[model samples]
Target chain A: MATVIVHKAGLLTMVQDRGRFGYQRYGMPVSGAMDVFSLELANLLVGNDPGDACLEATISGPELEFTGSTWIAITGAVWDPHLNGQGIPMNTAVDVRPGDRLGFRGLRSGCRTYIAFAGGIAVPSVMDSQSTYLRAGIGGFQGRGLIQGDELPLGTYNALLPGNELPPGEATDLLPSDGLTLGKAKRKPRRTKIPEGLIPEYKHEQTIRVISGPEVHYFELAGLRSFLSTEYTVTTKSDRMGYRLSGEPIKHKEGMTNIISAGISLGTVQVPGDGQPIILMADRQTSGGYARIANVITADFTLLAQMRPGDEIRFTETTLDRARLFCTDRHRVIFGI
Target chain B: MKEVTLKYIPSGDSAFIIKAGDVISEEVNLVVRKLLARFEEENIPGVTDFIPSYNELMVCYDPVTVDYRQLLGIFKKCAADLGAMTLPDAGVVHVPVLYGGEEGPDLHYVAEYNGLAEEDVIRIHSSADCLVYMLGFTPGFCYLGGMDKRIATPRQETPRLKIPAGSVGIAGEQTGIYPMESPGGWQLIGLTPLRLFNPDSKPEFLFNAGDYIRFYPIDKDEFEQIAAGVADGTYQVRRTQKIDNGDGNRT
Candidate 1:
């Protein structure tokens, strides 16, 4: 069996799948890859299922050693990765022989990265998911993050193509870094002509729309107006659990001490008694007792995940029709309709 | 009967909330449990999960398959039929515990804070058969009702980083089990040898949303034996309640 040995683990690295669903009622959070787009793309490039388990590295990538021949691809956040003291390109598949060393340095853009293999990593599924929830200490590599000398087992691989025929691309040189070429690399192949009305323009800077929540009346008129109009900067304390936004303190109608704990979800902006807004993320708790003023639509949640700490974010008020249209469009793209 | 107001709030894109009261009350918990039982019997078309809290029920659904309007309709129907629904009969769970010493380090402080002897506190805690109001905060961690008001105390100012699993503790008017080792602010009085949660086991969770629990004190040696058995995978505990079948008998 092929194996990947962890030599130098980054700040935070964990194997993540789509997520643990159908367990929220049991008080389990849907812990998974923070950036779903990149994770799926990496898996797709390697001929694996889109939702297959992949390593999710935060900011920095891990230094690993392959014990057998395997095909691997890297995606998300321009991390300059190198194999055996040579460079490897991002978004393209590469072959690694046994005893080859692979590692990454710092990030060029983006905060997360994904690495997928030809055969998925073998890990036990907890509650039908391989995703790790560190808080509960379960799922993914003995319910913990990878440490030094951890040998992860790889499943058997089916050879679809010869490794010699695969084109070797330029080691992904992170922008603003000195160019040090490794092996002979080829340019990306030309894209095929797309059918009319098939392509969607990638939107980078767009206002996230949200719907008023059950506790909308709890906030004063001015607070609600500020929440919709003003731009708030995401604080450095952001994580999978929630994003703590720094903005005007939302004033409640009354200084309620303790509201009854209720269900919470991703993108639910809860204003605690402290008046600051906490946007719950993928690994948020099942229920909370804070007053939520608005919930970001599912379509815009990926944009929120891409946001870096200190990035300014503005909430745009939109009707349910607009939100539904956005969600339908996203679904169509995902399903290739 | 005291009049109680229940309000429905939207939880998210596909969930609704049925709140009974603001605080933890026996009457509110009873209503919440009864409503959950009715929903199970009806088996609403789109309702995927219904999580009952101390005074609220968070019902989730798939928005693609079911809309908020349809969920609201079913919720209204469930609320209307709630009066006639019979709650599942409560089962008394006698959980053996070892109090104080190495097993329970906070037992002395808890007794001193409540101005009662160690034995008195144990008696008060184990005497009443408490009702499981909700299963939340963590898996199998039951939020129980029926704590004696005389011994009621607030949570610890500073939460313990890791409380051992199966440790019986009290927080405010409610008492609960630490199903897993997690950071909590509850006051620990005793330890139980029972495994509150095990993912490998059938049913996964030891207790459901509406079961009754009683604490029976066990000695240190017994606690060690049971704990060892739990570790080696030989100990088995039954946490099911008898239900009436369609026939003229109870199963």
Candidate 2:
């Protein structure tokens, strides 16, 4: 088995896959990569399945020493990643030799970054997922965040790469180009030669499209208007559990109070008694008592997850049809169809 | 035996909330869990997860795998079968608790707040077979129903920084057992010997929604002995089949 040694554990790093599924009945959270789009891209770049476990680093990233030769793709938040002191581009596969060190020394734009090894980050999966739920101490590496001296095992992957249409030295390689990903674009159902176009630009201020939540009617029209129109700054209290945004207080209707505790799906923008919108994320509780004024649509969920403390975000109401269209478009881009 | 209204509320684009009722009642919760049992037995693909809450069951699906409109249609059909569905027998879990003293830091306060003695509070709490409404906030933390109103107490003005695992607490009308250490405002009245959540063990959670918990007081010696056994994985959790009353309420 290949291994990646954690030289320096970043701010918050853990192994995550698609998420834990089919266990919500036990009140288990489906914890996975907060920005799953980047997770999938990282996996696909290394010829692994979308649900393959990988390293998810929040804000600051780790310094890893690879003990075996493997391909790795870094995605999501930009951290100005470096390989053995040489800079490497984000969203591109970089081949590493045995004993090569990979590290991210500085931040660029995003708050989270993903590094997918050739196969996957080998870890004992709880409830069929390697995602870490720190609150409950479930899943991932020792059911907790990565720390210094933690040696992560890597999974074995197949040699066949998807979109291997270009011959050797065909497309511009972010690093030295002579490997499996060289000729991978000209075949039927053509894959994009370079993934640069697909990478979303991380920004300080972004718009997150949302659909009305079940308790949206509980709020007054002014509250709804303010929610959509005002810029909500992500508070420092944000983590894998949820992001508490500080903005114009969304006023509820007179006599309207907290609803009976109901199910909270990912991206649920719940408004508590204080009237601030709390966007539930990957590690959110299965249920909550606060009223949900809106749910961030699946399309803009990744963008919402990338927002950092003090970063501004505005909610834009979108139709379900439009939300579906956006999700479909992203999938099409992923498959390069 | 009453027919409660079930409304299909769309939650974002990836899930649907099947609201069984506007209020939290046994009838509504039963309907929600009934729909869950029925929905689980279905062959619907793409619907990845189900969360049965106090008054609603949210079904999450992958829009890429199954069309949104098609899933909504499937859920509507599933909700239609609630009348024919019969709920499974409730599992009664006997939980051993060490009440008062250091184990229950707020037990005296609870009794004082309710104007009752601590022993009365314990007797009232342990006598009734409380229904497990749902589990959330933290893993294995159950939302309970059917607590004696005489023992009901308000939450602390300031929540403790860390409430230990296995701590039984009461807040407002709800009673809960913290599966793990978490910061909470609930008034701690006792500490349970059983581990509500053991991730390394099979059946990670001890109780589920639609189950029942009966708390029995134990002495400090018994608590320590049981805790040792639990730590070594030798403790057997006591469980029994809850005999149903004429009413369909699990309580």
Candidate 3:
């Protein structure tokens, strides 16, 4: 099999597939690509299975050299890519001959970048997934991140068609020119009139919608009102496990003791006794003791994940019907249903 | 009978909440268990998993197969019929624990805080039969439901960066076993010699929700022997049960 050699491993690079699902009961987080859209796009460009294992580079990208001919695509985070000392474009396929070098510069806008090769990467599966769970130290390159001098085996399907060449175009045009502008332009246009049959805008700068918590009355009215109206900044302590937001301390109405630990899920914004709100992420524990204030809709969870440290976020109350429609529609769009 | 308010809160598009009560009491646990039993019997469509906490049960469903409203209705019906239902026959599991000394480094501190001798602490802990209320916090980490009131202790002021796997501990009124070495804040009293979870094993988990657990104190020599058996793949700690219903209940 062909192999790719890492020359300079970047900030954080790990092999990730879609994610590890149906294993949450085992206390394992769904460790996968942070940006699913970009990951899939990279795979689609190279004709790999949508769920094929790819390299997820965070903040910065890795430098590598190929030992055999292969087709590859890089997407996400507008990382400046280069092939054999020459700059390459993002979101398109590239043919790399044997002994050629490939590398990426630091990220410009987003936090994650995806690199997908034809046929996908070859790695041992743990718990039915090739994705790396860094916390558990299993799966993906011996269940860890790629290191310099490490050689990754390419899958049997990594072969390119005979005489396949790079698509005919000026590659520079494909490079995202104004990443910041593009991101803002992609958002829905602001409108005053609520059109019939059109899905309502769930995205907002402030006021995240929330339902009355299972233990809403357990907290005093002052604490509840403060949680509903106040703004909280995502703390620097945030990671894949959970986002610890700093805001006003929420106090209990009376002397309350410990509660039994129960099952928790992604987007469950739990408020501990200290009043700090923790928005659990994909890698959160299966259970916790804090009283949950609200659960962010799954549709908006990806957006919340994209927020950088020190970003301010607020919650607003939403009905079940609206949240359901938003989630269903977003899923359909994401999976191309 | 004390009036308890059980609120049904929507968790997300695919899940609903059944809040039994505010505090962790025997009654709340019973209601949680009763609801869990009914959900298992009905096998409602779209319901993938149900997790019970001290006072709430979060039921997650597939949005495509069933909506939040439909699941909520079923939950309400189940809550109303809880009085007529009986808990499933739970299996009993005996776990061998190695208490005090090096194996349980925190045992002395726990004993001193409880104003008892190390041996006395062991007696009180092993005598009580704990219920596995839920499997959460980590894989194979059982949220046990019993702790002698006298031996109950608060968690550490600051969580330890890492606690070894199989470490048994008590936090507040709850007692549990840590299946994996992770950063924990619980006050440890002892440790079990058996592996609680192994990804390579056929049945990755040693315990499941609704199971009964009994701790059996073992000497350091026995603990080492069992640990060796676990590492070498010769130990068989799981007990098999036969169910005639042939439905998906057992699986």
Candidate 3 per-residue C-alpha lDDT over A293-318 given as tens digits, one digit per residue, 9 for 90 to 100: 67777656545755657777777778
Clashing pairs in 1: none
Q: Docking quality tier of candidate 3?
A: acceptable
B141-216 per-residue lDDT for model 2 (tens digits): 7889999888888899999999899999999987889888889999999999899888788888899888899999
lDDT string for model 2 (A1-337, tens) is: 5588998998899988889987776788899999999888887776667767888999898999987666778889877888999998778778786678999876878888989876576677787778888877778889899999999877644333444422222122222223432222111223212357677788999988999999999999999999999999999999898999999999999867588888888899999878888999998888888888888888787787788999999889998899899998998789662
Best by DockQ: 2
Each model's iRMS: 2.3, 1.2, 2.5
Task: State the lDDT at A104 in candidate 1.
Answer: 89
The DockQ for candidate 3, computed on C-alphas, is 0.42
Runs of candidate 2 exceeding 4 Å displacement: A159-194, B245-251
Model 1 C-alpha lDDT per residue in residues A172-244, reported as the tens digit of each score:
2112112312111122212111232432222334477787776888888988888888888888999988889
Off by over 4 Å in 1: A69-71, A82-101, A157-206, B1-9, B14-50, B61-84, B238-251
* Pick by TM-score: 1 or 3, better one: 1
Considering every candidate listed, which one attains the maximal TM-score? 2
Residue B248, candidate 1: Cα error in Å is 20
Ranking by TM-score: 2, 1, 3
**Per-residue lDDT of model 3, residues B1-251, tens digit only:** 23446787776555677888767665676677677778777878777667776677878776656777777777777677666555555667888999877767778888899899989889999997777766776677777777788888888999999899999988888788888899888888788988888878777778866667888799988988999999999987845342311122443
